[model samples]
Target: MSTEVAAEVVVAPPANDAEEGTKQSHKLERKWAFWFDTTKPKQGAAWGSTLKKAYTFDTVEEFWCLYDQIFKPSKLTGNADFHLFKAGVEPKWEDPECANGGKWTVSGSRKTNLDGMWLETLMALIGEQFDEADDICGVVVSARQRGDKLSLWTRNATNEAVQMSIGRKWKEIIDVTDKISYSFHDDAKKDKSSRGRYSV
Candidate 1:
């Protein structure tokens, strides 16, 4: 009989000792899942199903473990992706949190920036480093043959004030060579986007 191991949906990392020889403190006990896409043929499984759980982490230690085990963005196949989202939050356009959301996009062909940018974006999201932290839903990285794409998803697209705040902060955090583009979910759903606004 061929033994098949069930995929682990999520893994949470444990806490570490403090500098004074005590347990470290965490302001936000948020649970996050780190997903990896290694399936060669993308057509076989849904994006969510193909995702193998590298780990779920609440502490800083496990996050590094998950990050270390995966193939970096620079090493991934063109069609592969690495997604880290809040537990139970699927990295899909149609997800409720993402349905009305928009993404701040950073695109480039440079490999060095691609992987680093992805890591920075993750920090911006989970660390709540951006000014509009409440508006953020999650982050996604698309490692394509043509170019790598990093996008930060927000819960609402119509809130220009919040959207712009997030976009500008994103540019400041990442080594973005050029301006980052903001795309609204509604506008994205339409056949075309109406000269979408970009924060340069």
Candidate 2:
């Protein structure tokens, strides 16, 4: 995942900042990286530099540190993306790990369950809630001017069994009311059925 740039940006944990009686904690299976992509013309330079280290945490404390520092989806301008992936995997569509995989995309207005779904999906990914985590590459969220989108990428789109299970687990994790569609890179490229060969 060539963390050269990622290594430099660090998000530190909060101090004993929690109220004495109300502390909460979480543990994740693997360490993950949080990336903020700003795709605006004016924020180019600043965004580039701002791609600074967010934080890496296996425990809940560090995750909170990074999450707390970032702007919520509602506050982000259109064209911004937030990516969370297991350490060592870059969040690029072309990565060897992601070349064949496609994302199960969920789209909706913010007034819907967009934010809740995004957060739960992230929690599922980082918390290892999927049986096919071995095939999962990472997750990306786009806050577009049109609508917000969240995607979960797998290692290979051709693995129908794994792909279908992953898709089902994703939908289950987010527990959304609307239909969620799974698309393979190949199918998506052809502009055809983003439908999964199988559904979870």
Task: Say which candidate scores most in TM-score.
Answer: 1
Relative to the true structure, candidate 2 reaches a TM of 0.75
Overall lDDT per candidate, in order of appearance: 0.68, 0.69
TM-score of each: 0.77, 0.75
Model 2 stretches astray by more than 4 angstroms:
1-27, 41-53, 187-200
In model 2, the Cα lDDT at residue 135 comes to 92
Model 1: how far is 61 from its true place, Å? 0.8
Worst 10 residues of 1 by lDDT: 1-10
Checking candidate 2 for backbone clashes, the offending pairs are 9-53, 10-53
Q: Which stretches of model 1 miss by more than 4 angstroms?
A: 1-28, 38-54, 192-195
- In model 1, the Cα lDDT at residue 196 comes to 59
lDDT of 2 by residue, 1-200 (tens): 12343344453345443556577556677888777776443544532443433565677776756566562455456777777878877776556877777877877555676667767877787777888888998887778887888888888877778887788778778886666667777776586666655444
* Clash totals in order: 2, 2
Number of the top lDDT candidate: 2
